[model samples]
Target: MKKKLRIGILFGGRSGEHEVSLLSAASILKAIDKKKYDVVPIGITREGRWVTADDAHALLTGSQPPENPRLAGDPEATPTAAVIKRGEAIIVPPVPAESLQPLELHAAAELSPARPALALDVVFPVLHGTFGEDGTIQGLFELADIAYVGSGVLGSAAGMDKAAMKKLFAAEGLPQTPYLAVLRSVWRGNPKAATKKIETALRYPLFVKPANLGSSVGISKVHDRSELAAAMDLAASFDRKLVIEQGVGGPGAKPRELEVAVLGNDSPEASVVGEIVPGSEFYDYEAKYLSDASVPIIPAKLTAAESKQIRQMAIEAFKACDCSGLARVDFLMEPAKGKTKPRIYLNEINTLPGFTSISMYPKLWQATGLPYKQLIDRLIQLAVERHREKHQTRFTRV
Candidate 1:
């Protein structure tokens, strides 16, 4: 019998999406076949504690870990300074006229490497938003020399930043709506100038979002000039850079939410399309997580031509961003106005989309022939294949 792959399922990040991450990890944990893989669950709390247990869900659901004191990088902004917040890294020497101690640091203890932990053949990160989705965890995976599912550092970073993703999409000739990026410095230093640029370039009813957070945590729809500043402020609080987009939906004019699942590395493939009808005012966090009213139409009832076009477009978007393993590419289409061409606008891609059975990514795959368990199996295979390919490259010269 082939040795069962030891897969580490990581979840519960320091992000606001911590709860969502727990939900995803639960679904993935349930779907992975025990006969084929040994799943080790790793949970990080919002307060930044890393732990693994038979009761992994408890840590996440409890928020004791909070994954609090999490360490993440934001290239757009530099870290102020490394301050020992907690744990053993926070050590202080004896202050016998040589040192003064603080409450956070103890004089007796010394920093030591965390006790050796079991190595993982592959890891599946169910974490979302911020530190989890924005390449920080992926970079850690690279440093550990382990194979993991989803995009690598570059792809994860690009996918997390809607502003950067849109620019790359435009450069690749992919049809996209006009959008502007608000740098942290610009928004903080010159609010008036930033507001003018947004107002002049785009009209009222704009979508303000944090460039690197996901799950619509810091997203607001601005209806007029009066609401613009506040909307931008809410978004900027979550990230150093913010993305402003022209709103597509209006009263009774529902923007069709279409999503396609892409899988594999290098030569990747796209699955059938799925459509989501927002249950609330829009597809906000509540509509997505809290309410169960949203509808997901599989293989989205569209003309053959429309389906094929979207599948191709999904692949194009994936390749444009150099995504690997998997991504859920979302779209918004203006309803066909009296038989005119349906205008499809690529929204954003989730590098590590939700994995719960109800989530669109796996559901699309399930409709396309790979069942839940098999889909998880295939992702593990893809991880191994990607890792093997990595070994072929020459890192150091002889």
Candidate 2:
């Protein structure tokens, strides 16, 4: 019999999307093919602890329903102090001394017992936001010389920052909404100056968002000048930079939101377009994960030409950002009025989009003839393939 490949399903990260990551991991754990792979579930707590066994089990079981797998540990267990060394995650006890100086010992230093390693062949980082989605962890993976799912450092960082992402799209000649990027320090240093700049550059009814966050955590829709200060404050609290975008619609017409999923390393393919009808005034975090009012229309009602244009644009944006594995390219479609045709503005690319049951990334692929389980398998394969290809480059000249 062929030996099973040891696959690590890493989840529960130090980000606002911790719960969402847990949910995504749980979905994968339930669906992942057990016969072909030896699975190890690695959990990272909000305190930034890398844990396995009981601690990881507790967190996963506690967050999941009774029907899911439960562990033999306290539901509210304290996290352990662990670190990754030599490609293995080890639980290191607290250092005894408070001094920052290096210890001087004449070959008399005590050594701790060796901790067993997970010996993972590949890692599937189901983490989102900050340390997870912003390319930080991907950088670690590259340094550790391990294969992991999703984009590399460059693509992840570019995809995470809205300002940088828009610049890349513009360079590729992709159509997008006009916006202004603001610094939190600049806004706080001179509120008058920042407000005047924003007002002068863009119109009212703007979307204020934290440049480095997602899931609409620090997002506000300001209708007028009176609401701009509050929105800026809210966004500044979340990130060092804030992005204020011009709203897509006019008067009473609502901007229809559309999304297309892209998958692959070099020659990526785009999924059939999907439309989102938000339940709230905008598609905030609550409407995305909590409420049932929001509806998703698969193969969104579009003319053949419109569908072809958006799908092709989605692929262009994905490559422009240097994304791999998978991404969900979002757009804002202005409703056609009079002789004016519908205008599609490339919103942004999510290098690591949601994978929950109700998430659009997986659903788009399911509609495109790739089921959830097969999609997960394909992602893992892509990671290994990308890693192998990357090894071909020589670090030093002979």
Worst 10 residues of 1 by lDDT: 79-88
Best by lDDT: 2
In candidate 1, stretches whose alpha carbon ends up further than 4 angstroms from where it belongs are 54-57, 61-117, 249-252
Q: How big is the positional error of residue 294 in model 2, measured in Å on the Cα after superposition?
A: 0.4
The TM-score of predicted model 1 comes to 0.85
Quick one: RMSD of model 2? 6.1
lDDT of 2 by residue, 103-216 (tens): 222121232223244456788888888888899778767866778889999999999999999999999999998899999999999999999999899876799999998888
lDDT of residue 107 for candidate 2: 27
lDDT of each: 0.77, 0.81
Residue 281 lDDT, candidate 1, scale 0-100:
57
CA error at residue 372 for candidate 2, angstroms: 0.5
